[model samples]
Target chain A: MENKSIEQLNDICSQVRRDCLRMVHGVQSGHPGAALGLTEYFVALFFKEMTHNNQFQMDGKGEDLFFLSNGHVSALWYAVLARSGYFGVEELGTFRKINTRLQGHPATEEGLPGIRIASGSLGQGLSVALGAAQVKKLNGDDKLVYAVMGDGEQQEGQVWEAAMYAAHYKIDNVIAAIDYNGQQIDGPTEKVMDLKNLKAKWEAFGWEVIDIKKGNDMEAVLAGLAQAKGLTGKGKPVLILLYTEMGYGVDFMVGTHKWHGIAPSDAELANALGQLKETLGDY
Target chain B: MEKTLDLKFTYTEKKDTRSGFGDGLLEAGRQNPNVVGLCADLIGSLKMGAFQKEFPERFFQVGIAEANMIGLAAGMTIGGKIPFTGTFANFSTGRVYDQIRQSVAYSGKNVKICASHAGLTLGEDGATHQILEDVGMMKMLPHMTVINPCDYNQTKAATLALVNHEGPAYLRFGRPSWPIFTPKDQEFVIGKAWKMIEGTDVTIFATGHLVWEAVVAEAMLREEGISAEVINIHTIKPLDEEAILASVAKTGCAVSAEEHQINGGLGDSIAQTLIRNNPAPLEYVGVMDSFGESGTPTQLLEKYGLNAENIVKAAKKAIARKMSY
Candidate 1:
């Protein structure tokens, strides 16, 4: 990726937030809270941080890979993938539509570019990422495999299974990020299913845990990812607990569980879109 | 003019079909270095210890996490590695079906889900470990190939065959020491049926452990002044429609025997095929809507009506129905 200033990255994040709102509103059935919360992280990853090829290779050999384990945030990933030149920018309108590659959750079935696995069901992405990372190490690729999971998805027992597997196998090439927005579909994660001492949990699982206190801030996310990458190859896997506000950009949708899966109405969409600028021009 | 099938079939020894899978897996690993094995803490039980010992680096002990094992196998396919996941049929399919559906089958990853201890023949493990519905569950997936080899030799051949076949496949074998009747060098085809006997009266289609039972039923039917055609349906999915239709067209009636549940196992697949292509009188010889209990393999087979006597009864019933029609 070409060098982009922090202001330019922030402008891309604003555009991604806009894309998330319009895409979800168009379908009236997509996860918007996660898409909005992970906007800065996706932009920071696809635009400024990750060493990925936008040409959309499915195998992703000799290049860094990113897997969205919490696949409900397809709108955010689709926007970033398109913005990074993986596909046409206009294809964002087909999100969750019939016969479209942009499925409700990320998938490889529709031959979607930049996705290696089908991850809609929670707690499967980390295991897949570890597999890819192991293959990379075996092939001597030396590149990293990156992944992101929802903080609420930690309730799934398979996620811990993968965490233990990665640590036990010494899979030192993966940096797993979590969207710690504290909000899930029904209510807050703690009120629903408490994730008591998440950082301590990761540490106990034998991972080098990094906490990004301001995940919405583009600079902090970029640096936190860098810090996670820095911790790789030291005989352990890396985990980043990225603290972000659900629907960070939209004022009405911010910091609540109600906006997790519901799309904004016409009036609400107008209000939400009004807050997010069309910095990179609407897709 | 017809080619009369006359061949002597005998087994000098009895071996569990899972051992065939282990030997076949070792051969597959030798033929291709990219072939890898992963087990969920049942290496000894699943007969995967040989491959693990031969290729320790390629062998991954997933440690009781069937879901993770499936996902990891799916991921390994991206780097051109053919991963074979070993576990009990129940844990392999029912426990981690969603993982297989999403990661491996739906994604079209080239993963071999080699399952052992299938059906009621798993014996004293009872209804909990004996997975009679796995063949049905795996066959329903969009891009999954399901194979249930009848004997030890065929299980080994099928295991070796899946490495060359693309896409995800499910290979189901059992725990009991079955007869080693099939030739060791027999070519294992994916969707082709093996015609074991030729007859004009009724067609006996059997899979898994029940194939040998069908062979015995054929001899018994011959003594009753009725000819029986025994067809070994190893691959349940892709149902071998051509072979099935051709045989049923000749016999006019059919009997399906499997070591699985009658509701959704090989019987259901055969019935669906006949109902659409050629409607024929069909009788099922399998577990009839009930879970099994702790018993010896032979005790369970005899109690559940999964022996040659049951197949002969079903064959007679199918013939009677055909005469009524």
Candidate 2:
């Protein structure tokens, strides 16, 4: 697929937001908050940022790879992967359904084309990405590996372990993004467990931190991702502190943690869909 | 009656199974460039020094983070590299079970999880380090091949075989210096039982460090005018059901011995096979639902009923029960 302009990517983002809401609404049991929150990041990544192959292979040898560490937002990833030609866009209808490739969390068991690892269990994706990046370095592939994790996932100790490992090994060929949505399932992350000064924490762990103040904005997301890509192949892993809303495009679900995992009702779905534009055709 | 036993097995050298893993990893790396080794701060203990020295670029020292090592190994599989992670059995299975389940087993990644210091034979570390439930934990996971080779030669062979097996696997070994009796040139076929001694009275099925105990028990039973068959069951998950049923059909009773818990080890697997296929009197020789303490390997084996004397007693009990039936 050809690289799209910011205006075109924004149009796709709106469509992806609609797809995320409907996919969650269809099942009446999927995470919509993070999915809606990271729509622009997903759009910027698949549409304008990363250089990848649509023809998927398990061993993504020469092409850049992405791992969805916070797999709750799988609705958004499924939408992006389908729209980006990994699979038919119609498969979005199978989200969270029985015998569907799009599991509640992203999985590779059903041979999902774009999914490299199963990750609903948080704080593991970074290590996996680092491992893949090391392999690429060993094979002289020169391709970068990317990963995304939720702000709440930072509380996991394995995440810190991976953080220390990346810096200690000088694994510089990978980029990681934190979906800094303050709200989690139980409430605000600050109240849940304060991630005091997350930027300083990552920087102290030897990461080149890049904060995208407006992670929901398409231009900001694209620029931040591009900068992260540029920072790769240096001495330390790059991190993007992406500040996104819990539910960016929706009105009622925007600020609270209520929409984190709960699905929208028929009436609520209509209201959420009313907020997001049907830029491209829905599945 | 004709002579029932003509040949006796003997070992001239003793080595820890961990050394076999280290040698096998070096050999596997030499054979396949895609084979990579990852250790979580147990390089010398796991005997991975040779592999690290040989393939410094391919070797990864992931500090003491077993979970990260597991995830790294799983990720390494995405690039067509066969990664073998080394750690203690406790850290390899219990500490990082969810990591293995979500990243490797559920994803169906081809990562070899090689664990040493398994079972009570991990002596002196006590219960914290000894993981008797690893085989059961690994075998329960879908797409995981559980292997517990008996000796140095067999461990080496199993490691080499896993290089081509192409899926998630758990290779469990121990730290004790054990007798190396299996032939050095023997082919280690996963899921196939090796019949160490053939008899008609009782079948003694064993795995890991207990196989040598079963061999000694076979000799001890032979001295008592009792012909006992001894079989080495290496791969516990894809068990050689045919060999087991065939041996039990001829022997009429069975005895299971291992350096693991009685609840979820080789004995449990064998008991399930028998109750479902061939109902017969079976006696178990393993650690009863209990944790091990700090002791020498020999002392721990004797106290935990994991030695040849216990195996012989269990064989007699099983034979007596079969006779009464």
Candidate 1: residue B85 Cα off by (Å): 0.3
TM-score of chain B of each: 0.97, 0.97
lDDT accuracy of residue A272 in candidate 2: 82
TM-score of each: 0.98, 0.98
Q: Write the per-residue lDDT of candidate 1 for residues B1-325, one digit (tens) a residue.
A: 0012222355778999999999999999999988999999999998899999999989999998999999899888877889999999999999999999999988899999999999888999799998888988999999999999999999999999999999999999989998888998799999999998888999999999999888888877777788999999999998898999999999999999999889888899999999998999999999998899899998898999999889999999999999999
| After superposition, candidate 1 runs with Cα above 4 Å error | B1-8
Candidate 1: RMSD over Cα atoms? 2.6
Q: Please tell me which predicted candidate would have the highest lDDT against the true structure.
A: 2
For residues B1-325, write the lDDT of model 2, one tens digit per residue: 1124333677779999999999999999999999999999999999999999999999999999999999999999988999999999999999999999999999999999999999998889798998888888998899999999989999999999999998999999989998898989579888889998989999999999999888888888888899999999999979899999999999999999988888888889898999999999999999899989999999999998899889999999999999999
lDDT of 2 by residue, A188-244 (tens): 999999999999999999999999999999888877877887888889899999999
Model 2 pairs in collision: none
DockQ of each: 0.78, 0.91
